[model samples]
Target: MAYYISSFISPFGMILINILDGGEEPALKLTTEVLTGHVAVYHGDQIWRVEANPDWSLGETAQALSDLAFEAEIPEELRTLGIAALQNCVSDLYRRQPFVTA
Candidate 1:
């Protein structure tokens, strides 16, 4: 199962974000309503979107997005959106993880 999060726009188009929950196989059905057990990104309007496996860490997703942020395929005008999404997810993980800073 998974949770539908927010979506971000890129030069290519909208990049939908989904948070995977429980251990259920994805159905790949698209909808505007947020639900569980799926990580489907509606790409009817755009060709690219960041997606994570059921076992992948959001940190990994953030890293993947970070890496994609610099790809030649990504337009300069919208590069920051992907990077910002990655940073936002990373920042959320940072605050959620247990850590001690000096």
Candidate 2:
């Protein structure tokens, strides 16, 4: 029953991946691009995609999370954990604002 999030920040934005159950068999995974609002959810052998929304609003990350979760066709049994992962990623991206190196 282990759950964790891994995030990678880039100049463009941040990419977040959520792993469950030590990533063993029957693992659950969700990934999102924070700035782009693009999402992917995995359960068993199938992956579901939530397209990136063109609308951009730094203040609306939570809204974006809901929209992404709503759009994803993730299995009902895995939905809660999957969405939680997405939420964690969004929060991480918001807390660690992107920086530009000169």
Candidate 3:
């Protein structure tokens, strides 16, 4: 069971972030749709796996994109997308914690 957090179109493709099985961290999945052959994945705040399609995973490109986000070096137009995705994921996880109070 994965909880979808956010998604956005980028140079790479349609990037989506989700929490896998109620996990605390987010998993990033890159998809190019029917237009191209790009695909990748991001997990554990790192590049968990990446490879060519139809195999699913996040590679170096996705890692670089996230790195730029963390370093605040992503282009102005794309800035905040990744950061917001991460923030949203964490916020949702925190809210789900048993000890959390209203």
Best by TM-score: 2
TM-score of each: 0.40, 0.50, 0.31
Estimate, for each residue in 21-55, the C-alpha lDDT of model 3 and write its tens digit.
35565544322333444443444455423333433
Rank order (by lDDT, best first): 2, 3, 1
Tens-digit lDDT string for candidate 2 (58-79): 3243444455556666655456
Worst 10-residue lDDT window for candidate 2 reads: 7-16
Model 1 clash pairs? 1-37, 2-37
Candidate topping lDDT: 2
* Candidate 2 stretches greater than 4 Å from native: 9-11, 24-26, 33-38, 54-65, 70-78, 98-102
Q: What lDDT tens digits, residue by residue, belong to model 1 across residues 41-102?
A: 32223433444444544454445545544642534434544355446645654576545111
C-alpha RMSD for every candidate: 12.2, 5.4, 13.7
List of clashing residue pairs for candidate 2: none
Q: Rate the local accuracy (lDDT) of all candidates.
A: 0.38, 0.53, 0.42
Error in Å for residue 29 of model 2: 2.4
Clashes of each: 2, 0, 4
